[model samples]
Target: MSTLTKSNHIGRKISRIRELKDMKQEALAQALGLSQQSISNIENSETIDDERLIDIAKVLGVSVEALKNFSEDSVINYFNNFYDESAKGQILNNSCSNLTFNPLDKLIEAYEENKKLYERLVQAEKDKVEFLEKILKDK
Candidate 1:
């Protein structure tokens, strides 16, 4: 891919990530203080400003680098190739449906990690609010 195409691919990656998280464009727009149409435009753009990318990543609960480099196919391929169940006699039918890499455990683990991270973010926000309130009361 050319540099321009590669840059545009980042927008697609962001769109995919948002979809995977079950987040609507309207919700993302609300978080970014933008309109849904604006979010659509951003997803169709070739590039985004670094600061804006950071803001979007924060709203998505992911790192900016993750947004930049995320690939759904890579994750699927990794799981598909990581385990060979047939070789271990786990696949008796030898059917495509019986082919199992068993990525559900990893997905669950990632979900738990994200939940903890979200809780930490919420606590940090609460702490910031309390600090600000304490300062106002002191004044």
Candidate 2:
């Protein structure tokens, strides 16, 4: 008789959302000006006041409704389908996409940057030698 209703554990939802956002309890506590122990207590709570929940939502950068509606299954689904509709149904979430990126072009760009740096270094050495020559001539 106890298995059908959805869980309304607001604190648990908050905890999950915080973890998904890569935030630690200590960081969240600092944002809310509360101690870590207080954050722990809040997470262990089954329900939070509306005002407190709104404050937590602000710190987490989510709407209060988003916090309340957070679900592990939904998150998993969202990440598992990370392609944009404009991609023509191409799976663009990883390196397996059929994009036209040339590694040789990237290598050439790196070489050009390195050549500029080498030129700068050589000019600096020449400048140092010139300064030293001036000093020796003065002596």
- Global fold similarity of model 2 (TM-score): 0.57
TM-scores of the models, in the given order?
0.52, 0.57
Candidate 1 residue-wise lDDT, 34-104, digit = tens: 99999999998868899999999988878998898787667677557656654675645433465344568
Listing every candidate in turn, what is its Cα RMSD in Å to the true structure after a full C-alpha superposition? 10.3, 14.6
Residue-level lDDT for 101 in candidate 2: 59
lDDT of 2 by residue, 1-139 (tens): 3536878788889899989889999989977879999999999898999999999998887899998888778887776665344356764545435435576896797698679879999999999999999999999
Worst 10 residues of 2 by lDDT: 91-100
Q: Where does candidate 2 stray beyond 4 Å?
A: 1-3, 83-139
By summed lDDT, the worst window of 10 consecutive residues in model 1 runs over 91-100
lDDT at residue 127 of model 1 (Cα atoms): 100
